[model samples]
Target: MSAPGLLRTERARLTALYGSLLLLAGGGLVALVYVLVGQGLYASVSGVVRTVSPAYRLPVPGETVDVGRSPEPARTMAPGETPTPEELKGYAFTQDLSDAVTDATRHRLLMYSLLALAVFAVLSIWLAWWMAGRVLRPVGVITETARRLSGENLHQRISLDAPPGELKELADTFDAMLGRMEHLVSAQRRFAANAAHELRTPLAVQRAAAEIGLAGEPSPQKVARIRERLIGVADSSEHLVESLLLLAVSQEGLEPGSTGPVDLAALAAAELAADPPHALTVVRTLAPLTVTGDRALLGHLVRNLLTNAVRHNRAGGRIVVETSSDGELAVSNTGPVIGPADVPRLLEPFRRRAERQHTAGEGAGLGLSIVAAIARAHGASLAAEANAEPEGGLTVRVRFPLPDGQGAVRGAPGSKIG
Candidate 1:
């Protein structure tokens, strides 16, 4: 439905709710007043009857009574004396008058109460509707802001200026959310632009090589060289595609069914052993460490870390890989000294240090980004710090919490070699 129609429906619902609550409260108050007024009037009439009843002089049987004087006391009368017919009639009339007065007063009170209730009910509904509209005015502003927001106008905010209460709080929170959304959208746009640029380079190279090879009368040697170059381009493209896919998967998060006990220590050892760094000395301090996560993703994380360390290392440098039973995995390597300021940007996709940018086909700069994503998916903490040594490098540590029913096992303390 349209926005206006939805807003009207919401307002109507709120008005109805307010009106219902007011009606219930007003009805109870009117009922209470009706009861109290009726009781008070009845009591007043009864008091009048009690006070006036004693003044009436009724004649007694076989007794001579003065017509204008006060009636004789009952105790002074003889035991056999009985009330005359006139006295009985008079007593009945007085009782009837008292009852009539009480009934008349009660009827008048009931009529007034009903009239008051009818008038107040109408007024209550109108008042409730007005109050509801006032209360919902801020909501209307919020709705308008949301309606106007899009990718092109994500920077817009409600910025409502109202009293310090729930409405103000809601507006502030909404503005904060919009700010965050704007940041993420901007970041995503940059990432897409960079990725497109990166992908196009390899394609352009391949196209140029193919076109040149097919040109008039290419020698066999030339053809062989072109084929090798094309293969290198294809390899680079494949690596970029794989890295992008892995980054996407890491961002998408792990499914519940894919989670199980994973041995991080074993995965680290396996990765190091499979691709031994020839030029760099490798140190292993792996111990038995288990965590709950997707095994494949964990292995990918380990491999990425190992690859980054090897790819970025200097000749004859050392790489240290360590795992603790307490669910800690760390990798450090010797390379060109890295600045502390560049540590954070290294985890962002498509971001790389200037030194590594010229290393052809070595990486797509998503190695640590994928590792960070995978660590987030597994509820683990990943931290990177520039080495404190005069010779620069990076130390990346990933700490995973043990799964339920698994206790942490303390082993020898790991060291940070400068």
Candidate 2:
């Protein structure tokens, strides 16, 4: 059934349940009252019988009563005359009349009690229905609000102004859930739009190049030039695709099988060895820093920071990579001074600072975004700050939580001394 129909049905059921309970309770009380009234009436009649029975003098069967003095009086009839059958009949009728009155009074009392009980039953049921509606009013509101909700109207909240109770708590929890869903949906929409925009640029470039190359006469030199241009476009497309894939992986988070303890110091050293810095002085202050996370993702995090630092630096500039025993990894580089306002945006997907210079084949602007994703996946903290010097540069730091049974080592904060 539809939600509103179901809710209405539930309300009806609640009313019925309440009415049934009231009937049971009210019926018991009425029955008790009826019994008490009957008992009291009977007791009063019995007391009257006990108090007045001795005051009346009635003749017994086969007994005589003196009507006049008859010591020497002439007898009117036989001395032991019996009562006529009519007199006996009249005596029995009188006794039956008293019993009939008592029976009629008892019947009247019973009828009145039942009438009152019937009226109260109806009243109780009506009251119960009303009370049930009052008690479930909040639930009805929630149901209606939920029924009206859709993706476009996710901003609507229950906002129930109710007293403290379970219903209020339920409304609060539902509102919180709606808030989270709204955030996630908004983020998803933004990501899709950004990804489409990024992918469209390279595809458009490749298409334009192909059309230009095929539009004219076919010559060997021209064909070679077209081939080179096409290859460069293909290369850029490939790089962008790879970056997108990595970003997706980071956002989805690490798999259970890929999680383990990785030494950050060792991972940084290995990445530097594989891709050494060119025209930039590299300094490393590596200490053993162990953190529990996915090794491949952690490697990507380190690699991206290093790449960002190198690609954005000036000629003969310096890069400093530091890892401490306290699970802190920092990368600082000397480049164009950046504004403090742009620091936060640099970590968002497809966001690049306008002041920072980019070399050819630098990146697709997802380096720091991936880093931020990986850090969040592993429950680590990431902080980025622009250098204070007039030359302007960026410093990125990631602090991983210490592993189980390992106390965090405290030390002085590291500085960029390259």
Q: Which candidate is the best by TM-score?
A: 1
Between which residue pairs do clashes occur in model 2? 337-392
Instruction: List where candidate 1 sits over 4 angstroms from the true fold.
Output: 1-8, 49-90, 160-180, 210-224, 253-261, 278-281, 292-294, 314-317, 336-341, 355-358, 389-391, 403-405, 408-418
lDDT for each residue of candidate 1 in 1-418, tens digit (9 for 90 to 100) = 7866855676677877887887888788878887787767756775686456643345455555443324654433355887767666766765677779988877887788788878878887788778878888999999999999999999888989899999999999999999999989987998898799889988988899988775898999999999998888888889899999999999999987999988888888888779888888998999998899999999999998888888888888989999876778889989888787888888888888873453474677889989999989988888788887665788788888787666763442332211
User: TM-score for every candidate vs. truth?
Assistant: 0.79, 0.69
Lowest summed lDDT across 10 adjacent residues in model 1 is found at 409-418
Q: Give the TM-score of candidate 2.
A: 0.69
Q: Per-residue alpha-carbon lDDT of model 2 for 1-418, expressed as tens digits?
A: 8866865776677877887887788778767876786667655664465345421223444544332223443223334565446445544554555466567777887788778778878887788778878878888888898899888999999999989999899999999999999987887787788778877876887788779876778788888988887787778778888888888898898788888889999999999999999998998999899999999899999999999998888899889999987778899999988877778778877777763232357577889989989988887788777887765688887878889776764443432211
